[model samples]
Target: MPEQYDAIICGGSFGGLAAAQQIGGRVLIIDRLEIGDGETSASAVPIACLEKMDMTHVIDQVHEEIYLHTRRRTQKLTFFRFCTFNYRQFCEDLFARTGAEFVRARITSARAGRVETTAGTFEAPIVIDSAGWRTAAGKGGEKAARASRKSFGVEARQPYRGEGLHFYVGPSRGSRRFYWAFPAGDHVRAGLATYTGASDLSGDLERFCDDLHLGPPGKVHGGYFTSRLTDAVRDGMFLVGDSAGMCLPVSGEGIRPALVFGQVAGRLAERVRTGEMRLDQALSAYRAFVQSRGKGYRILDRLQSVLNVLPDPLFALFARYIATPRMLRYANRGYWNVASPDLLTADKAADPLPATAVPA
Candidate 1:
């Protein structure tokens, strides 16, 4: 007999765990790979989520100063607080608390209220696809999401010393993007992101390290940052994180938003399971929440286009101006919050209905 669950979630990552943590009862989390194996994400999430979730202990480093590197000079911006943590471990720990039964399943198909996996079929009234860019939970929808832009980031544990979070913004051979070096105690996450091919990024990353007089990273890691935005809900299926484009355009910060969205989706799933809301009603509610919450990300999408058009010189000048001491305070705060308000606060007004209109 197929196993039954209150909700079946795909991809046991940040967004998936977030949903599981909030959705009580018999929940199942499926993933093809072992948890956190071969994962190289040194994620930086907002301090608010970390504090609320009691995950502040996962933080490996806290950065209050930011250094923006340009062609001519390195502009220093201070007073912005960012915490870098081991995202893989964060997911693992959070998933453990939800008491969700985990299965090793490479999902073959997902429909309105059923999931077929290599291990077995799982049935639920509500299904959530919190999977990352791969969108494994969005099975039977469209093919893999097509990305107009892509990024490759690698992190290595080698000898490095940097007091603040460093971001490199300048000319690359390919599409416009910036490189970042986040110091995480023992190692620094030194990687670049661009709308270019992986091979091109690899070469560029090598040159970037050499130019900075830092040793080359060992065992460089890479993954998709975004696959463009797609529908967030349909037929009792919900997609969060990169699948729903929770990630901001230029900054690509998805952790905080993913947790917030996943929690909302999970709570709605609970309401549906308990008959507080109908399945269609739950889908509508989820769609409305995603649309309203994603407005800021949509704005960032446009800003990325503008940054792409500006010449290297112009971009450098703009960066320098933003980093000036007089503007740094405002810039520091704006940089972290360009997408939306602190989600932990902005999401308190969540009402399951009548806020957004859905197309018929």
Candidate 2:
């Protein structure tokens, strides 16, 4: 007899844990490292999307705004700008509370029904992949076509106000991308992001440091960032979070999309196990669901394109206009509804913040 579980989740990071917590079953969670050393290792958030999902235990702090900037535009983003996380602690707590078995084993190979790990072999009727930045099951080749220009970023907490998130746009040395500085408690998270094959960023870092008011020779790090989705759901296996390629392409924001998809994936995984849906249906459903929530991301991409076409100063002026407090508030409420499933109804009114008008 094949040793079985209701579900075997091949990851224990935020999205994996979230899926495990939402479902009912004996879940076996597996990962290469005992700790969350993937991108989840160091995540900065002004978490506005998952507020209604009841994962409050994982949140570390919430900020007031997401300050927006570009090479040419500076705006105060008053919506969805709350950074709250203790990635490692949050992952541990999810498993501990949910009573899911976490196996510290690297997944050597994964097929329709079998998962080979460092420890032993495991088989389950249903498998969900929450692995970040990888596809062990061999369904991700289509991702190459949807790839974004590779970019890099580094985040560190600096001594600063613990209230609002700030950003620096368009001062990097080489090709003009954006740098970010979100308030991480007392310290600030300052990092730069750019397309991978575009240009070398070493020269850009020097200019970025001066532009962002960070005087430094050795105080930062950078790496690739992109939100590429793949043909994820396959066979008895379902993919959620980064493994499913749910990161935001423009901003490279992964947490909100990951959590949203986690909820969706968990529900679908349960359905597939109980015979309510087939794998193709579930994958199609998830794809449609993500496309719905992806409106803002799509819009941002278009806006970025327009911004890129204009001269840098002109683009900055546009950003300055959009960053007014009122606009940020509208953006926050709009994106909040977008990220949360329960809040999207027509009758529901999003929260209103105090209005600050944009200059004409």
For each candidate, how many residue pairs have backbone atoms clashing (under 3 Å)?
0, 19
Tell me the deviation in Å of residue 109 in model 2. 3.0
lDDT of 2 at 218: 59
lDDT of 2 by residue, 21-117 (tens): 6556677888887744554323654453444544456665677766676644456655554665666665665567556777888786665678877
Query: What lDDT does model 2 reach?
Result: 0.60
Which one wins on TM-score?
Answer: 1
For candidate 1, the per-residue lDDT at 69 reads: 81
| Error in Å for residue 233 of model 2 | 2.1
Error of 1 at 213 (Å): 3.4
> So what's the TM-score on candidate 1?
0.87
lDDT of each: 0.69, 0.60
